[model samples]
Target: MAYRATMQEQMIRKGPWLEEEDERLAAFVTLMGERRWDSLARASGLRRSGKSCRLRWLNYLRPDLKHGQISDEEEQIILQLHERWGNKWSKIARRLPGRTDNEIKNYWRTHLRKKVQEQEQEILQRAINNAVNPQDFLLQQGDRSCEDDKSRTSSDILQISDYGFAASPYEDRLFDWISGSSSGINEDVRKHNEVWNMFSSSSYNLGFVSASGDSIWDYNSSSSSWNLDEDLQVVKQTWNTQ
Candidate 1:
């Protein structure tokens, strides 16, 4: 953190702010609210740019500056404000009480994305774990919805491996999810996916009928069709010789 003003107060010319100069600026803003950085700079006899003064005061000296990782709640406001206004750090900073827009933007770039990725990975891992050794509840769902329909079975059920789930919100619910932009895309994405799954799933329906029902389908689409009464001869040819 470079000092915004020179420290000596040597009545010196401006090159950069020093430690002592920072102390003076702090004293000035403390004595009076930072109404005008230009006025503060001149009155303090620092002779620095008003923008510099403002930035110094706001970014550094203002009795506010909540440093060290903005809270999740504060982060939401920052992202929302940034999205709506777009990179006007000053404007965004105003909406925040003690946070700087630069801090917010930087955090968004470096930390936020990583945080989101980590969270997503955790969710994906959780889902994968659940899929393998699914709890009685999810298992019951499989039993009732998929297995009950003799025409289809959980044996042919799709795994997370079969088709990766993207985090984008499925449309019908975007109206609900985007409404909470402050809450963020990932949160809404989960809700969106849940809703999509709820709607898309009732009874698993196979896209193509196997010409032979007894064949062990490898999910090969081109050779997918097999006779209903007979084992899929194509699949049987490879696995079951009898």
Candidate 2:
């Protein structure tokens, strides 16, 4: 019996089913209703194994099986599903009608695999190119000038000017008060002129004020103290007069 079994196994066909074999297998599958492939193979008198017969029927020989180049829409679906499910080809095949797991797997190996790898490499290269060094970033920030900071501050004030008619309300009022007061220099205008003069002077530089830890008000040599509340009240009266 062992000798006979060995002879039978040796006699079994492998690789590339003939057209006659395919016809015979299909007829047997139709009569038997696609179950017990071992028995079906034996009954059909085909030398191919049950697994081989099953694969052939499902992958190619089936009448319902689709055989053509995969469409663009189908290719996109395969890519999306492959990304989500990984190498679950049988699972992926279930989503696509008439496409076998073997066909899908082979397509992925031949076509989609390299495409996916190239995409991953491109993304990695882009990330490598865009990566910023911490030290370089810090040095770039440190290299920025105080003049640039002042210009940015001036630009911010100018941007605020765009929201109003030509000049901001506070700037318009301050300019009007200064222009009007220049003709008849009152006590308030005199104090204002003193403040302006202090700002313009080289001794009381605005640039060094932050570093020196000195107040702009400290430049006042007069014994009379400047109260912010009193100054605000005088400014309100001046605005009222205007």
lDDT of each: 0.53, 0.62
Tens-digit lDDT track of model 2 for 161-241: 223222223323443455345543243344344443433343323322322233323322122554545654566575556
Ten residues in sequence with the least summed lDDT for candidate 2: 159-168
Candidate 1 lDDT score relative to the true structure? 0.53
Candidate 2 Cα errors over 4 Å, as ranges: 132-242
**In lDDT terms, which candidate is top?**
2
State candidate 1's TM-score. Answer: 0.38
* lDDT digits (tens) for residues 188-222 of candidate 1: 44443443344245331253223344222333234
- Candidate 2 lands at a TM-score of 0.54
lDDT of 2 at 26: 93
